[model samples]
Target: MTTPAVLLLIPASSYRTHDFLEAAHALDLEVQVGTDQSQVLAEVVPDRTLVLDFFEAEIALAAIAELHSRHPLSVVLGVDDESVELAAQANQRLRIPHNSPTSVSLTRDKFWMRQCLAKAGLASPGFQRFSVASDPETLRDSIRYPCVLKPTFLAASQGVIRADAPGEFNTAFRSLQELLADPELQKRGGERAKWVLVEDYLPGLEVSLEGVLTDGCLQTLALFDKPDPLTGPTFAETLYVAPSRLPETVQQCVRKAVEQTAQALGLTTGPVHAEARVHQGKVWMLECAARTIGGLCSRMLAFSGGMSLEALILRHALGRDIQTAQTISNACGALMLPVPKDGTLHTIAGWDTVREISGVEAAVQSLPNGTAVRTLPHDARYLGFVLVREKTPAAVETTLREAWTQLQVEID
Candidate 1:
């Protein structure tokens, strides 16, 4: 039997590469990493890595075709937001099973996403898109109070700000304009940087839905209750506890809303991470992505037989039969260790103490000592994640909060 081979379109900064590679190993699949970073090719075994410009779709497709000629690819997958559209395009060109590039594009642009949902009669917030070049004062009268300003493309809450009045809205608009002008954001966002999305803020408790859409049907894997309120001048998500405490009826509503939203967007296959708010018995779809949960948050999920979330995704991609996708019966959660302030990270104290707390699974830091970091509305990266597992959702949430209070981050 010929060994199955897969191509992974990953960015240099992706946190999921190691997990994906490990899953590939478990499945006995030959893995080739396609990246824009030439240095990354050297870090991997020479034959296993393909250097390609992810920003240029045509060039990237040509590179993938060339790689496929040498070793046939059974699946093409994207590890992060930056690569999703590229992967979708590659899959279409290769005649592989995947969602359409157009569908993925709708999800990437915040304005378009809202438009689609609203047209479908789904519960979507009032939204408008404005070019950064436009005069803020001209748009001021149309602005609604208690709204959010967001970069059309950037995720992880970067350049997302809440404005309560005209003064705050103007400040936030200009702040986003400056943020989008940065070379890094411009390179990542391209034309998306030229526009910003303003949407009415939905007041409610937030929850996340992790699921997969196969044959245009949504099968929910987990519903995470964000115990920490996401009310934001800047939304920095903290603890997320799985097996949400919401009543069964509300869970059903969330599931139905996500299913309808995916259908509306024309997303058919692969993993999806969606966020929504529930207030007064109404579910307002915030945003949905045609990718797995970001960062190391997937570590909080596992299947009935101990299959990792990455493994299930790989299995589905490979067309292998997955008997079940149920999350482990034990309650689990994670804390995105908050960045206290903007500055150079001098040190993190009490990691050992935090880890020693009962039910605290692991506390892993992403940034190195002395590296510069910033809080939300200006930055998106979390300092680290603390994962926990307990018998009940409340216990897991409590453990995460207790562990968080024990640690102190000092910045210079």
Candidate 2:
């Protein structure tokens, strides 16, 4: 029997590449990585890494085609948001099982995503798109108070802001304009950089759904509860605890909403990560992406006997049988260590203390000393992540919070 070879599309900066490679090693599968950085090519998978620009899909697909001609790939997977569309396009070209490129593209654009959900009779907030060139004051009359302003293509709350009134909206609009002016962000968003999405704010508990879609059916892996209310002028995710404490009925509603949203968006395969708000027994779909949870958050999940989420995703991509998809009985959670302020990070204290906390699993720092870091609306990367496993969800949340309070970040 020939071993299945898989091609993975990964951003050079993404933290997920290592986890995916670890899973592939365990599965004994031959792996090749496609990235944009030539220097990283030798660092990751050595001779197996192919240099491909994620932003230029046409050129990326052409390079992938040439690579595939030499080594046929049984699976082509995107490791993060930046690579999803490219992976879909490559899959379509190779006739591999994957979500349609059109579907993936729709998910990337917030404006189109809301339009499709609303058209399909799903629960979606009323939203409008504005151009960066439009005068912020002129657009005021069209927007309702207490709404969110977001860049159409940026994710992880990089350009997400909330406005309680027209004045705040004007400020947020201008801030978004400045954010869009960022050369790196502009390069990532392409033409979508010109548009901003404003949506009526949905009030309630915010939760995230992690699942996989196969043959148009959603197999829910886990539902995470955001214990800290996401009510925001600026949204910064802090804690996520799973084996959600919500009532079973509410959980069912969230599941149905996600399933419907995925169907509406025409996502039929691979992992799906979705966010929604539950308000007074009603579910409002916020957004759904054709990829797994972002950052180190996936560390919170583990199958029956400690199988990582990455392993499960790889197993599904290779058409292997999954005996069970249930996470371990013990509750697990992760905290995205918040950046105290925008400045150069001088040092981080309490790593040793936090690691020694009961139930603490790992404490990781993503940035190094003297590295400049900014808070949300301009920066999306977290300082680091803290993982914990406890007997109950509440305990897990408490442990994560307690550990977080002990740490101190010095940004000069």
Candidate 3:
């Protein structure tokens, strides 16, 4: 059989995509990169490399269709959430294998996700959607105090805020509305002025599960324990430790919840990122996406044990064999570059000192110096990340704390 060429839709500079492409070449798969245009045939070029951006739906669909109509390959795949929908649309039109379109919509829409979970007997936080928050009185009655308000569609913790009381809710609502109306945000998606989700703030130990699903059956891959205290108004994820220290039963319960959610969402193929709260021995599903974890910050499975989640998902989406691709290993954790204050990043101190910590395997500063950063509801900036491999969880925690202390972020 001839080798199948794969097209990856991502920004050209994507470090994550580069990692996957390297792995694919090692497996003897050819790659092609382009904007989603239907005329770009992969089958014609047995060996090619292309990375396309499919953030815009119409353009992406046209490109994929153009390619499929000509190349007619064994597989076509996309990793971005925006492109996931496009892929599903193309799959139905092209008769290619992919996650169902219905599932994509449900998972991408945080509002719909809550409903789906509640209907399936899975625990979901109480939520309310606002096309207009005209009355503070009625809105206050609907949501529990100390709630979270955020855009229903955007990620990277953009537009997410906590409202501790009625007064805070009104202020946050207007502030978010204005932010959405800003020139840049308006260009991104704010012009539509769509609905926002206000939900009961969940206070518990937060953990994230990364999994792979094939033909709708889930194989639990990795569990990450959130090292930062997330019980608050601003849920900033600072640290992630894989192979969670949770007991066996709790782990099993979390896994079961994730699998059931996958089935409900019809996430049959590809990687799924699920966030849940382990509160009082009960696992509550908070959010899930049909894409791999973002920011390349949490490398629990791939960078952790050498099992490339991105590669496995791409191969699986294209209908390739992936059983041999996944492998688990020692506990892996990532600490997002700590945000010391809201200001421009002048310099980071104690880089050499953190390197001296025993478990730290890799440390890199992700942000450029002189970049102005601020606190969210607007800012989600980190200086760098520290990836560590340690013999025990305690050792890992101690090492992270020691490293965290030694490092100084000068935000002025």
Model 2 clashes, total count: 0
The alpha-carbon lDDT assigned to residue 202 of candidate 1 equals 86
lDDT string for model 2 (1-412, tens) is 8888999888988989888999898889999999888687567698998999899888989999998899999989998999999999999999998899999999999999999998999888899998988899999877888899999998888889999999999999999999999898889999999999999998999999999988888899989999998888888999999889999999999999999999999998889999999986789998899999988888878886677999999999888766477887589899998777999999998999999999998899878888899989899988989999999999999999899998899998
Ten contiguous residues minimizing lDDT sum, candidate 2: 320-329
lDDT of 2 at 17: 83
Residues 249-296 of candidate 3 have per-residue lDDT tens digits of: 999999998999888877788888899998767888887888777666
TM-score of 2: 0.98
Q: In candidate 2, residue 1 scores what lDDT? A: 88
For candidate 1, the clash count comes to 0
Q: Is candidate 1 or 3 superior in TM-score?
A: 1
At residue 102, what lDDT does model 3 achieve? 93
Residues 227-343, candidate 1: write the lDDT tens digits.
888888999888899889999999999999999999999999899999999997999999899999998999888887778888899899888766566887589999998788999
In candidate 2, list every pair of residues with a backbone clash: none
List RMSD in Å for every model shown. Answer: 1.1, 1.0, 4.0
Model 1 worst lDDT run, 10 consecutive residues = 38-47
